[model samples]
Target chain A: MSNKLLLMGDEAIAQGAIDGGLSGIYAYPGTPSTEIMEYVQNTKQTAELNIHRKWSANEKTAMEAALGMSYAGKRAMVCFKHVGLNVAADAFINASITGVNGGLIVVSADDPSMHSSQNEQDSRFYAKFAMVPILEPSNQQEAYDMAYFGFELSERLNVPVLLRITTRMAHSRAGVQRREGKPQNSLRLPSDPRQFVLLPSIARKNYRKLLMGQAAMEIESEKSSFNELISGNNKSLGIITTGIAYNYLVENYPDQKSPYPVLKICQYPIPRKQVEELYNSCNKVLVLEEGYPIVEEQLKGYLNTGKPVHGRLDGTVPRDGELNPNIVAKVLGMDVAEGQPIPDVVKNRPPSLCQGCGHRDVYEDLNEAMKVYGTGRVFSDIGCYTLGALPPFNAINSCVDMGASITMAKGAADAGLVPAVAVIGDSTFTHSGMTGLLDAINENSPITVIISDNSTTGMTGGQQSSATGKIVDICRGIGVDPNHIRVVTPLKKNHEENVRILKEELAYQGVSVIIPQRECIQTFARRKKSEKKESND
Target chain B: MKNDIILAGVGGQGILSIAAAIGLAAVNSNLYIKQSEVHGMSQRGGDVQSHLRISDKPIASDLIPEGKADMIISVEPMEGLRYLPFLSNSGWLVTNITPYMNIPDYPDINEILAKVKSLKHHIAIDADSIAKEAGSSRASNIVMLGAASLFLDIPFERIEEGIRQLFGKKGDEVVQMNLKALRLGREFSEKNR
Candidate 1:
């Protein structure tokens, strides 16, 4: 008997890793990827299978921890969104040179169209830069099968594999078949004792080895069973699809019959043979890729291609935004009913802070305190408070990356933007804001840093934050003057005191951190329910 | 048989719980299901939706096609109407008339109901009052699901069993309250019919 369960793409990866003998899954919470680690943590499989699953302080730490597990000769999987990859890039780029004893797979979930992200950066580019093999699955079953087989492939290739998925694949659910369980790798060190060590003498040789393996990696791609060529009756148009884009391409042809040759590419490195065959077979090619036109560019060549290549760069399909079945249908010259435009009565309803949230109190008071300083002085980081840029409050000015608020505020302060204030969240403060605070303290940048301590990662479904119960100590230990490290409960009752403290910190010259301490209302509500249940029992 | 439903509501309005109920029922009937949810930053009091597709055969795409949804089950009137583009021309629209007004520019309550009534196949009810009468107002999403269940091709017993399996952890009293809310909603729709 076989096992079939309805699982999201992220859950499929988690289950695949579990079935594939994953030793550990280390990751910081982020969209479309957070559920991967959460699934393992809440599963009985982790306990019975002796898998290590825990939330790390940040993506960089998580990446390094996965690398450490790989160093001990155990299979490891690190999952994160595209931006989190930016945080972990330092560790990722080096892992290519250091190679691995056991298999290591980095699953980067890209949010195309900026769904809950700052940018729609393609992670395949990162994988290409790192000079690693990439497995881009096209469906939920493929997502599962790739993870089930990805570890072995990584070990065989002796390099980390990048499994890139978009928001659609990660969040969507479909039934996935399971494979037989495998035993975890026994403890073993790398054959080269100094391989992991990045000393120049050993690294130079390792770099040469990595570069030498590129041709072999390309051969592996050409031989990958995931890559396929489907022949049709007619050869007027050839279609090249990678990852989820294949689903959309096939969706246009319900009976799976089209009058065009199709090269469905799930594994990367272009699979030169398959591309050459398709290009030689068809008159023109339509490249369907979710993100950048990387494949089209390569196929088009520097001087020009043999056949006209049509894609995002050529305006065959819109360069920006997501590719849907409707968009695919339009591209295929099929009839698509255009949905009516949104009624003018339906105004823009952007995301806002929850009612009675502690962040609301913090913002309400901060707006009052900054009335004299005017607008555009507050630089915010990613979190629920970023919504303060909306109407009712109109509080914060800028929100660049995860921890750019403090550093940006410092730079502005140096550039004569007086009273430049930085607003950040509890989880975000610990994520990357701490280092920037240290920099500000060292230079004594004239800025007031407000750390809205909500006791949990409020924006991401209230995950337990690393800064919980240690925000004050963290501020004090980070070299901020102890006397100036102010803490207040962000409540409607304490609005006056909160505003007064904000005023005081804004007036102060040196760096000051005002932590508005309050447990997130959602988590608090959950706690109350559990507490009441316990009392009744 | 196939059912494509768009479960709609504001973030934190318990639309997922409603989707879970239908998903559990669909799975128990041995039907294939694909549910795509909105996660991350937009979930913070923003418009949120889930596309739930159930079929006897294996499902292809996680998302339903435009103007092809069989029904729209929503916890808020505005949220339900927001997804009219996804509904087929003859699709059923079941929604709560209550406005969870977190936005500053929320429209007049009568205006929303009038628009909903314009649909040939629609059921607009105040799920909040019915849920409050049953037990807890948090079960309003369940009520909306019950009203929508009248139009689903799936059986009613499966949905009732689904509620039992979904709310099994919350104890009998809470479960009974939700069950009452579900039945109350069904009775109201039947009375209107």
Candidate 2:
């Protein structure tokens, strides 16, 4: 074993992919999951190992690039945060039916509790809907091991694997066992054109093959050591826990005296036979899975016995909230000591944009520009700038998802809404907004799409966006008239100019593209530090 | 036995690092520790708190319920008062008296000081001043952590060891500054008591 290093879950996934002999990694950076791609890109071993890493235009392009690599019979991986999955869902759902020529792993780090996200949608459900295997790791070590295994399983099953990690699993640090690196898979040219072609007839055949492959996958799951049956002294109670919840259960068991047998599952399409055997062996079965009761719900249908199943659905564990060790112990009939009461600590601290942030100045200018136009005329996209929807500056009226701003603005303009403006980040514009931009330009919709170009993917930790240097040209190339396009600096000193330009574009009576360019605050800080170091050297 | 500690401070005050150090110390002592942190826009000058649960056995929940903390360590006075509800009635509060209010509309520093004085087991230290004296304002967290050590049974040596391990890679200058800050904080808390 290499030196056992304490690594964050995100870093562990990156290391796991490297150890798993991934040949290509395509990703558009988003938080929690951003570190995975960044780690792989920065590691000295990447070039030594001949790994191909690139920041794609958007999640869809990233997903497609990964699929293309898998088509060449090489291990490929794509990563994005929870919402990025929405941008790539079209390709993601179809890829499940299309299967794969080689190993393919799609990692979606779900942000629970709305941390750095608009919503806390579980990605495991997406995996289930796509009829693919999903793996959720509880800690850094599991994240590493599962990611490695996810690749092998994907190749073995001839299907894409979804490795779903939550914010806790992505950011938390734990000691991980290092392993000797595996050699990259030998490349193989496409043997049959029909495999790549996803016509209805071919897709139907592949879909049936997917169904036929489920039984074998379940058998594989049963034999896999990742899911274990940990038996204790008590036969009356049993606990079925998976992912981080398993860690919570193990940690909460007082005196290590768990009265029940625990079938700890970290992989899914859960080994139903193992769950059944454990269920049959115990008097009462309790499910301790996180996110949704995917395991608990599935076990209910398969069980023939009269034993009652307890879990999220039954309210034994919380159905809507994140789990902790104390909650798990209470459900297990353990008497844990309650600590002293906490005093009232009331302080209302609202989220604020960073000091000297370019988004701040842009929002100020945009608000002024919109005031001239009318109220409720602006639609905003996701990014660091989404905070504009909050106090002091309510420049944006709607923010649903990536690229929603452009489409929503188009919709509002078509309905004769005056001075419709869509504000999106440069990264977001490439992610999913560009298509809507094209639509607006082609249809000559009377709207203004403001691309807040911070020269990076600002919200999710500053990963480079594919359209970093080409947004203006791309807009013009897509039939947006150059005369109608405007670019401005989102600096406090340039506030008046930015507002003036925005107002002019808003009144253009046609699709006008506005590019507000600036550097993200964090990126700017990092660059300053690097420059200082260079000067010192 | 479970030990619930609430570490609170304004964002950017290194409250998370202090909690992380405590969690690492507990883990090193052969105990099971579960830690949950709030992440979002909070790191940008908002109120920040981390829940650190250390037990000889397993911990069940990530959050310590209201009024259940064995100890509350506040890096800032206002931030400490904000998390007081998590502290047991008789629980100890170790905080820096200095006010580091990032947002406008902050309560008067005198009022905050008066409120803290009402607690039975309150130990206030001028951690910011100590850190400044130590030649690095960033070491205020270390100093506050040092002051909090007086109320806990965890050895000063363990904390010293943890600090060393955390700053060891940063080089000798940082290591020396932090060690000085920690020792000064410990001395200030002891003298006040």
Candidate 3:
């Protein structure tokens, strides 16, 4: 055995992919999941592994590249954050219909509680919708093992696998069992060219095959060793836990002795036979799963024994809010120690943009402009800058998703709203906002779209956005008047100038785009440190 | 026996390293251990925390419930106080006395310190100063962890071995400096006790 090493969950996934004989990894940088690709790219030892790694233009492109590689009879992996999945939804859903020729794994790292994300969306539901298998790992080791196994399972089932990890699982470092690398799979062109061709008739036939394949898929899940039954003598209660929820259930029942059978499922869709057997064995089956009641709902339908399945559906577990051990214990009728009362150590600490953050200056100027116009006139997109909706800088009115700001502002303008402003990050504007800008230009909507160009994807880790140096050019290409597209630094030093420029844009009649150019504080700090080293040398 | 520990600090404060060290120690002791951590916003100086569960049997959860943690180790005083809800009434809190001001608005730093001092079962150490004395401020996390190690069943030798395994390749000087800081922290904690 090799010496033990501390590896982050993302790094472990990368290592697992290499060990699983990955031929290629295609991805775009996003928080929590960015390191997976970065690690593979930077590791000197990986050169001998014959891995083809590329940073795709966006999540959709990244996914399609991996699909193409998989179709060539090579194992491939693609990764992106939760919201990036939305950009890749079209490719992801279609791949389900056109089965895989080789191992293919899609790694989606979801940001819950809106930590560095547009919304706290769980990506497991996406897997469910696509009718594909999903694997959620609780810790670093499982993350590594599941990533490797997920690819194997993908090829076995002739389908792509969704390996959903969360913020907690992506970044956390733990001891992973290191394995020797495997030889890269040789590239073999698709034997059946018709499988790659997707006409309406062929697509319809493939879609039916996908539906018919579900029965065997369920049977495969039942026989899989990942789904196990942990039992006690208690027949009055049974708990069905999946992914991280299984971890919570174990922690909650540490000291309690209950007559219940616990079904721990790390893989999905959960085995219907296991749920049916669990229902037959217990009076009530309590479903414990994070994100949504995917397993619980299926159990409710599969268990014909008339046994009550309690979970988020029946309000046993709160429908909203993240679940922890205490919440699980409370539901399980277990006694948890009472925590010491907080002695009002400090007031509630609401998250805010960092001091000297470009977002701060941008919001300050935006707020001033809003005061000049009217409140509730600005539409915001997702990013670290979206915190402008909070107190001390109540600048933005609505924030739906990544590129919704531009569309929302255009919609408002079409509805006869005056001085409509759209606030979006430079990275987000490139991700999906460009299309919205095209629509705005086509309709000649009288709205101002403010692209907060921090030169990085600030909401997630500071990764390079695709439109870093090309915001002005992109806007010009999209038909926004070059003269109307103004750029300014959003800083305390440039506060007056930024506000003046914003005011001018708001007053302009046609579709105007404001490019606020500044660097994120974290990236700026890193740059300063590197420059200092260079200077010292 | 099951031992659950929670480590809290600002992002980039080496909270995960402490958990890794503890996890490594457990692995060395031939115990089953499970640990989990928060990722996003962790690099942005946000409140980052980790749970390390060590048991003779398999660990069920990667998270420890409020008041169930036997020990709460923190790299920052404010972070320690922020996670007070997770500490058992009888649990011990070993943390650095240094305060980290979070982004957005926060209460007076002194007020936060006062509240932490008033809380029972707390031990405050100038871990940052110790680490600085050892020639690097980043080692403060290791120092705080060394202070907290006095309460855990895991032996200091195991911790040292884990540290060696983690950072042994960084060079002898770096390893020796951290070892010195850890020893100094242990001595200070023993003197305080």
**Among these predicted structures, which one has the highest DockQ?**
1
Residue range A1-537, candidate 1, lDDT tens digits: 013787889999999999998999999888878888888998897998789897889999998999989989999999999999999999999999999878999999999898798898999999899999999988888999888899998898788899998898999887788889989999998888888989998889989999999998889889998899889868889999888887777756756456688888889777999999999888899999988888988888887747899999989989987787778778888887543344545555689887889888999999999999888899999988898999898888899899999999999999999899999999999999999999999999999999999889887788879989898888889899998999999999998988999999899999999998888888999999999989999
TM-score of chain B of each: 0.97, 0.93, 0.93
Answer with 1 or 3, whichever has the higher TM-score: 1
TM-score of chain A of 3: 0.93
Could you arrange the candidates by TM-score from highest to lowest? 1, 3, 2
lDDT of 1 by residue, B106-181 (tens): 8887888888887888898889999999998888988887888888878999999999999898799988998999
Model 2, CA-based lDDT: 0.80
Interface RMSD of each: 2.3, 4.6, 3.3
Decide which is better by lDDT, 1 or 3: 1
Give the TM-score (0 to 1) of chain B in model 3. 0.93
Best by TM-score: 1
Estimate, for each residue in A277-381, the C-alpha lDDT of model 3 and write its tens digit: 777888888888777677777667765456787898889999865678888888977787777665565444445677778888888888887786779998998
- Show pairs that collide, candidate 1: none
DockQ of every model listed?
0.54, 0.33, 0.46
Task: For candidate 3, write residues B1-92 as lDDT tens digits.
Answer: 77788888877667888887777887888776667676655455567778887777755656778888888898887777767788887888
Structural similarity to truth (TM-score) of each candidate: 0.96, 0.91, 0.91
